[model samples]
Target: MTTSKQALPPVVSTATWQKELAALRIREKAVTRELDSVAAQRRRLPMTEMPDYVLEGEDGPVRLAEIFGEHPQLIVYNHMWHDGAEWQCPGCTGFTTQFTRLLGLEKFGARFVIVTQGPIDQALAYKRRVGNAMAWYSTANSSFGSDVGAPPDAGFAVNVFLRDGDTVYRTWHTDGRGTEQLSHLFGLIDVLPYGRQEVWQESPEGWPQAPAYSKWATSQEIAAAYGEDK
Candidate 1:
């Protein structure tokens, strides 16, 4: 049986919504400009020779260079998967879902890879959830992650690299909002209350949201926390 959808309460689109759409477009252009600036700034990251490193993959131990595969730049995003945590971070997983495919990234002389400090299975499990099997690897106890600014306990962010001849350089990095800028769609839409018209995710009459709150809650916990009907 096809149950009819609930009708929303009568409402009028007034000044409230006017700035919303306009802000969205404004944000879209702003984000694009920000990205262009980021690209230009990326040219300044400290240079480093291809440092020796071991990354255990689905196959086994593989050196880092293999990811380049003739590409001049490498964009490795740390997915911030914690092994001992009760659950995976849905926010991070959700963001990765918006991440463009490697082919798209590779076309620009850049290849994106997700390196995690968590156990292989822990990280792999989350990746499988999003079906983002993009070139993933495990750093184990190596400082490669922290050295790049993502302390295991602190979580992960996007890090960009440039390969010039045999030398590799750390060019750019983004954390939180900066990382949110990684995906233009997420920046202009998800960050907004009404979101984009293309993806229909209308906010409830009043969706009370807390930007930063108590400890993060799991899906099940959230249901209980909101007194949502089972």
Candidate 2:
């Protein structure tokens, strides 16, 4: 049996294309403004006092409060890691790749780090495998993961905290697709005609798409593709 290719969008004159683009731009601007408004509201949200959770780090056991260092804010990426899995979740790895270098975040008084439920040694090994320089810690014996809305098998999450002198507060937290904010790849793909090329996306007829998550590869798999060993 043979399969048929999907049809592409109709070709249009330059002037016609510009007209359609201009219409889309209007809605795009509206979206931008709305997003800005929502962000402003997010900034005004009241913070809740957080527990003094402890996690294992490369140096040794460290308190969540101490992770802030001299910074006034902290952003932790909760990564998914099962005990016996060969590698971490592809989506979590992809999200973390975008944060390999977070030196710029220091300028804004925020310290960024990754937290996982796996053993500290395993987490460190994976970090080294991916060539990530950012700090990583393991919440193996702590409720930090669940308290932050990232359970053992819950996948990915991004949580923000604020430090006030000797106290720490949970400022914001988001999980699931909200974690996409940490993904630069998806942001870049959104500008393309086919977007992420995921089956759930509403692409134009004839555009390419495959089942979502079907093409996701683990960090080790991705590195091996480039001749690097985990």
Candidate 3:
């Protein structure tokens, strides 16, 4: 196979490289500090009480509080869905794949799971198809998805909740680019020279560019990689 010519940055002396990196480091550190401050403010934000909506679990109907299990904090990723479709949203499918192990969350008194607009069986089937290890549930029969800003047939979202005894309160909800902080893939891609290589980013001239998500794979493609068919 033929490889395309790659555009590269100009070579510089060691001293010049270190000087430029150090200058950029100052801005990086400032951004880091600003993010920390935002996180601190998020921790202080007030929460709203949530109803004990019944969602479909692998077994049967379960209350939202019951899904929390023994954890006092619950983080639900609202996975996007398409009714009667063979595949679901690739963005959500790929994003949720990043969370294979969640035992680390339990140490912080938190549990992480997925809620989808698709039926429970379809969601679980897709979960198996993608080899996702997180607990999957269905909000198809409830308004929980819309209530938390991830309506049916909509995009993905991350919703945080705190449990006080039998009652649950919504602490925070984020969608769109707000979910980027949780993506290890995005975090690593953003540090590369090309930096996601997407058209919308403000990158230096001569950098390679493609439309957003052009490099992304569909759920079917990901599943097929795992030797799962149907």
> Best lDDT goes to which candidate?
3
Span of 10 residues, lowest total lDDT, candidate 1? 221-230
- The whole-model C-alpha lDDT of candidate 3 against the native structure comes to 0.90
**Better model by TM-score, 1 or 3?**
3
Candidate 2 lDDT (Cα, 0 to 1): 0.84
Q: Which of 1 and 2 is the better model by lDDT?
A: 2
The alpha-carbon root-mean-square deviation between model 1 and the true structure, to one decimal in Å, is 7.6
Per-candidate TM-scores read: 0.67, 0.91, 0.95
Per-candidate RMSD, Å? 7.6, 3.0, 2.2
lDDT values for all models: 0.66, 0.84, 0.90
lDDT of 1 by residue, 1-230 (tens): 88645434345587867766688899789978997896787665566554766677777776676667699888888877666876556566555555545677667888878888887766666565455546678888566788887777677788877777656767777787677556765556566544442323445654433344222344344324332242
| Model 3 lDDT-worst window of ten | 221-230
Instruction: For residues 133-160, write the lDDT of model 2, one tens digit per residue.
Output: 6789999889999888888977678999
Which candidate has the highest TM-score of all? 3
Candidate 2: pairs in clash: 6-206
